[model samples]
Target: MIDTSMGLKDMSKRDILVNVAVLIGFIILCMGGGGIMGAITRNDFGDRSEWYKALIKPSFNPPNFLFGIVWPILYLLMAIAAFAVWTKTGLTKEPIPLVIFFIQLALNFIWTLIFGKAKDLLASLVEIIILWLFILLTIKKFWKVNRGAALCLAPYLAWVTLAVALNYKYWELNPNMKPDYSWFVLKTEL
Candidate 1:
């Protein structure tokens, strides 16, 4: 009986290590995916002040530099939220929520490509709406396992909501706006 108890304790320790490793792996994957996408769609404009000069922004728009500060922190929070879900329940059982999280991540990257690279304001707006929906679904699912996980994503959802509205305003104001290939050069001049 003592031997059997020892075996069970060993098994429990192994399980705990495995779960911790898995959570770390998930967090790394989430951050790595976002990093790769950011690299691929990186803006070439050096001065970033060019972003400010673009047509006319909504009066409520945050300063351009704030975007740089906001996104990295938000991405980190999202990865932690995902890790929370993974640690609570392995990926296989709660497939639906995991899938929704991935869908939103894909949508999130697509918006970056559309707005930052392709400069398609309307397309980015549509993508953000889809991203918002997926985030809501993922939050609902994660809440079942870890309410903290779900709560962590709330700020991301709120930011996307603001982004969607901003995108809509830009599209409305600059109906004929196209991707400015000269942005890099103009930024250098500034």
Candidate 2:
């Protein structure tokens, strides 16, 4: 008997292959979208700021190189997680998970802008906390339709946890360093 639970109750091997190919194509599209966003974030923000370099980071803080490595991997995992959920529910059946996923991803970009571009540790802390909650919501939404998709987000959650701590510590350690980023300051920074 075909596995209806998988939503793959179909006819021929050729059909299955084509369906899998389509799914793969979708996953690739998601990855590409994610990559483009990441590249834009990287190019726009482009490395640790002078303010960031001057901060008194906690000993627990990972190196700049580590973030460079982790973020791309996390982005890939996010794409895979979304792909898994899409395979289960499709665009019509339930779209909330995908919407939440995209929201969290956008929040991810915002956090980078606050932390990396503005160098506003306090604002970044707040934004990252919001991002963290969105990630939890996305994972919960994914869990309802696909457990593996939820599991894929675990690393992203963990990394954000580290970021929360780092943001808090930097804010705490260098009260002198918090840049007042008004619209004027933002324009100057840009």
Candidate 3:
């Protein structure tokens, strides 16, 4: 937006550009955290065919490749929504909305670890439920700050709802799948 006579209150071109940059930066930060965590916990080659593929998935269950595409978009939307709230109440002052946002963000990563790394279907179901609630809370708080921001999270909430179904279906189908926590246990014969 080119502003010839720059009003004191009106945003100039530089302001607009700067805002875009900041928003993009916010998106990159969120995506980076999620991507890093996913990389850490993800199976080799990003294809868990040997593991997840072997399991019996429901008909509604999406192809694994779809997840690879969907998550980045969701993360971007989530970051934009959070940034909108952050603009209203920055880190300087303790903001309840931001607090909820961070909590949900942490839960997001935790869910990935539980499902992907731990391979605990039942536990993942429980954790995803908690994450969904936190996302709702964050959306409610964000709505008070910016309606568009809250709306941005709607897709995320919807996706998670679908994920809940998927998680439940997997849990129901595979009654014998348990997390292998033996890695943490020591094998001392003594």
Best candidate (score: lDDT): 3
User: lDDT-based ranking, best first?
Assistant: 3, 2, 1
* lDDT score of residue 78 within candidate 2: 85
lDDT of 2 by residue, 1-190 (tens): 1122544554567657755775576556555665665565564342535555678889998867787688778877887788778767776778889888888888887776667656687888899999999999999999998899899999999999998998899899988875544523535453
User: Against the hidden reference, what TM-scores do the models get?
Assistant: 0.78, 0.77, 0.82
Clashing pairs in 3: none
Please give the clash total of every predicted structure, in order.
0, 0, 0
For candidate 1, lDDT tens digit of each residue in 1-190?
A: 0112244456666666765676666667667777776676555322443652564678988876687687777888888788777655656766676778888888887777677766777777888888888989989988987899899999998998888888889888888777653433545453
Please report how far candidate 1 places residue 56 from its true position, in Å: 1.9
Select the stronger candidate by TM-score from 2 and 3.
Answer: 3
lDDT of 3 by residue, 51-170 (tens): 686678899988778888988999999888877776666656548987888899899988887887778899889999999999999999899977999999999999999999999998
What are the lDDT figures for the candidates, one per model? 0.73, 0.76, 0.81
Number of colliding residue pairs in model 3: 0
Comparison by lDDT, 1 against 3, better one: 3
- Between candidates 2 and 3, name the one with more favorable lDDT: 3
Residue 137 of candidate 3: its Cα lDDT?
Answer: 94
Q: Is candidate 1 or candidate 2 better by TM-score?
A: 1
Best by TM-score: 3
- Sequence-dependent TM-score of model 3: 0.82
